[model samples]
Every structure is written in structure tokens, then in C-alpha cells.
Target: MKALFIGGTGTISSAITKQLVEQGCELYLLNRGNRNAALPTGVNLIQADINDEAHVAELIENLAFDVVADFIAFEPAQLERDYRLFKDKTKQFMFISSASAYQTPLSDYRITEGTPLSNPYWQYSRNKIACEDYLMKQYREHGFPITIVRPSHTYDERSIPLGVHGGRGSWQVARRMLANKPVIIHGDGTSLWTMTHNSDFAKGFIGLMGNIHAIGESVHITSDESVTWNQIYEIIADALGVKLNAVHVSSEFLAACSKVDYRGGLLGDKANSVVFDNAKLKRLVPEFVATTRLDQGIKQTVAYILAHPEHQTEDKEFDAWCDKVIQALDAAARSITE
Candidate 1:
């Protein structure tokens, strides 16, 4: 199968990219070629900004693909650009949408593809919803042949997945854990969340590509394993060989105090308990099963980060922010006691 992936080297798409190559599928990645991910031989790379439609069009003028999946499109306008370029060049055009597009605070803690898309707390999610709507409309009206795949909190070996982290990445939180510094966990850390290892996500996703059943449908690929936020942190700490010094804070208070948009990330998405029902995905991709448990995945991630010093990027600003938030909470406790 000839598949074209735009922005293939990411936490979610990278694993899929590697898998396609391993299967000996004719895969082409169209991106700026800036990421450090090693591409297996026999894979083609088209280096260009996907935003530059005219230039990208010229580059792939006569090329036709069985699948053209864009992993970087966030907003609808970007999808509009994608629609313009790959309209007829590919048989199946896949859009990587976010699972966070589901209704915030959720009427039901369980999520299926049928779950209504409405996220007021986050414009990012709302934009993803718009993207899906536009693509689905094209599929219905003009036969754009779009397939949407939403992934919930998919992680790779490069970075640890944590509920609370700074703009830089989750490495800072892991560093704090290693140093025995108090690591802030959003909410009480008991809110259930799902994390899918990228390889596991890749299996579900690859099963959908080129399959006629997946066209005009939106499916989320995630592990069925749902663990509490506290459990998540504790697992990471265990992997790092450190006793967790967890400081739990309310998502609301964290949002109010921090400059980062915790309201969207936490309130809109993570803070609330969420359990993904992968029934539809199972029906579509019968072989798909998330084998890597949270403990196993977190341990591998922590190990990868530890071995690769480059991934251990320090975010001094976010670290300072964390310190400030922790100090304020402590002071508030003291004031209440006094």
C-alpha cells in the first residue's frame, strides 16, 4: 500500500510510521524533515512545509497514494488546506483528530465515537471538532474520502506522560521526581484516565488505513486500561526508583494560578475521570488490543528518558512555576491553620 503521511515523526504518528515501514509498505513522509527520528530504509521522505500547498503540490504533482494521512492538522483551516491539496490524489485521506474533542466534563464518563463533540473549556478541542465536521461534510457532500482517527493521551519512549507538566514537556516532572522534589499532580490524582503506548495505538490505526469500513467514520484508538492520575504518578516514580513526593492541587486553583491553560488541558480534558469504550474500534479492527499496561509502558518511557540524556530537557521557567504553585498552596494551608 502506498501511503503518504504529513508530519509522520511525532509521539503518535512516529510509531505508525515505523510500523508501516517494517511491514514493507510503500510509505512516503512529507514534512520539513526536522525531527530526529530515524527512518528505516526503503521509506521515502518529502521535505517541505505542508502549509505551502502550491510548492507541496508541485513536489507531488503526478503522485497518487492509497492513503494520505496528515498528523499535524489541528485547526479547520489547516484541514481546508489539506482538502485543497490531497482532494483527489489519495484514495483515503486520514485526519489525526484529538480525542479531547469529546464534550468536556462529559455527560457520561464513558466515550465512544458517537459521543457528541463539544468542548467549551478548550479551543484546541473545539477546533479539532470543526476539522472533523468539515471533513465529514466533504465526505458526505463531495466524497472527499476522509477518515478521522482520534488518539487519547498516546505516549512514546521519548517523553513520560504526566497529568501536570509545563509547556516544555513532561521531563521536568520526571526530573522533579528523580530529585525528590514535590511533583504537582492535577486534582487529587484519583480521576481515571487512559494512556495508550504509541506502538499499541499504531496497531489500531494501521488496521484502519486502506480498509473501506473506516472511510467516512471517526474512530479513536486507545488502550482500554484506565488508571487514576495518582496511580499514573506513582508508577512513574516507581520506574524512576524514587519515592513520590506528590503534591495534589485542584485543577481550578492550578489554572487560576498558572499561566498555562490548565483549564483546557485539565478541566477540558484530564481532570475529569474518563474511560474509553473501544467497542467500535474492536469491531473495526478485531486484532487490536492494547497489551502494554500502564506500569509497563511508564517503566519503558522512564527508562528511555533516563538513557537518552537529550530527552531530559530542563525547563527552568516551568520548574520555577511549579515551585511557586507549591509554595502558595503551602502558605494557604498555614494561613488556614493559623
Candidate 2:
């Protein structure tokens, strides 16, 4: 089987590519050629930006692929372009979406795929829901073979502290606790979070691809276990052996800062709370299991942070905030347990 992957260098895409290669499927990676990553030996790399539909179409025009895994599709225009470009040549098109697409309010802790999508005007969630709707529409209208995978908080070795695929925000809190810094909690830090390891998510994606029955369906890829923010901070503090000193910031403050016209502020707005349900995914991939526990994932993240002291120094304010929150959380947990 021949498969083409978009955004090959990204953490999730990289894991998918590795697994596809190991499965003996001929692989092709398409990207803008800016990121430097080690590709599996003999895999074809095509340098083209999907934003330029004409160029992307021209590059993949002659190639017939059994599967096209789109990891970086965020805009409806891009999804439309890809469908028009490869609808005939590709047997199946898989889109990588986020669990945030669920339309239910953030307070709704357990969200399933059936939930209504958020408003289309909300940038990040809107874009994903739009893309998913476009794909499903195409599938119904033209019998376009497609699969949608919604992943929640994927983390792995390639994960950076604050970048895409960053482990849960709790990692930053843990780092702050270790350094005897003050951590800031947005709201009460009572929200529940569940995360899937990249490797496990990749396995689920591959499993879906191999199963023909999985076509024309959306699946949630998430961890079996869930942890609350308070629990998460306490776990990190225990791991790092630090005292808790944290400030509880009102959610209004976070909301106000997020309203600022800046990328960082916008990101903060979108990341305050996210929760999902993976029951359908679990039912679909019965054999799939997450190997990395939250404790282990946190330990790995802490080790990486300590080894890369430069990162901490570079983001001193952020680091200090993380420390304070973790410490405060730990102290709070101890009080409750006592």
C-alpha cells in the first residue's frame, strides 16, 4: 500500500509516518521543507505548501495513493483543495482533528463525537469543525472515502515544553514547583484533563486505516485515565520534591488577558479548559492501549526540562508561574489528605 502524509515533521505526523513505514507501506511525506527531521530511510519527501493549492496539486498529480493522511489541515479551503485534488487518486483520506471541536461548553466534562460543534467564528475550534464538516459533506455528497480522528492532548519524546504536542500544561506547573517558584492557576484548577501518548494515538490512527469498516466515521483518540488539575499539580510536585506556593487567579483575569490582540494571549484563551470522551475510539480499537501513564509522562517531561535549563531561563516569568502553581497545588493536596 502507498500512503502520503502531510506535515511529516510534526510530532503526531512523525509517529504516524514511522508506524506506516514499519508496517511496510510505501510512504511519501509532503511539507514546506523548513523543518529538519530524520525521515525513515528511502521515504520520498515532497516539498510544497498546502496553502498553495495549485502547487500542491501539481506535485501530487501523477501519484496514486491508497491512503492520504492529512495532519496539518486546519482550514476548510485546504480540505476542499485536497478533496478536489486527490478525490479520485486516493482511496481514503484521513484528517487529524482536535477534541476541542465539541460545541458543548467547556464545563461539560465528558464530550463525545456526537456533541454539536462550537461556533464557526471561534478560530481554532471553528476551523477544525469546519474541516470535519467539509470532509463529511464530501463523503455524503460524492461518496468520498474519509476518516476523521480527534486527538486529545498527545505527548511523547519529541514533545517540547510549550510547543504543539506539549505535554499537558501541568508539566509547566511541575517545573515551577521544582524551582520553588509561584504557580498561577487560571480559575480554580478543578477541570479534568485526559491525554493520549503520541505513540498510542498513532497506533489508533494506523488501526483505523487498516480497517475498512472505520471509513466514514469519526473517532476520538484519548487516554483511558483522566486527571484533575489539582491532582496533576500534586503529582508533579511529588515527583520534583518541591514546596507549594501558588496564586489563584480569577478566570476573568485569564479571559481578559486572552482578549489581548496577540498570539500568546489568544493561545491562552483557547487552552484554559478541554475535556473529551474516548469510549467510541476504545470500542473501535479494542487492542489499542496507552503505554505511558501520566506519572511516567510527567517524569519524562521534568527530566527534559531540567536537562534543558536554557528553556527555563528563557521563559523566566512563565517558568516562575508554573513553579508557584505546582507548589500551591501540592500544599493544598497535602492539607486535604491530612
Number of clashing pairs per prediction, in order: 1, 10
| Candidate 1, position 28, lDDT | 94
Q: Top TM-score: which candidate number?
A: 1
Shift in Å, residue 299, candidate 1: 1.0
Worst 10 residues of 2 by lDDT: 160-169
TM-score of 2: 0.81
Q: Which segments of candidate 1 are over 4 A away from where they belong?
A: none
Provide the global lDDT of candidate 1 against the true structure: 0.91
TM-scores for all candidates: the values are 0.98, 0.81
Question: What digit string (tens of lDDT, one per residue) describes model 1 on residues 1-338?
Answer: 99999989889888998899999999999999898358777779999999888999999998999999999998989999998898989999999999999988799999999889999999999999999999999999999998899999999999998888888988988889889999999988888999999999999999999999999999999999989998999999999999999999999998898888999999999998889999999999999999999899989988888889989899999999999999988998999999
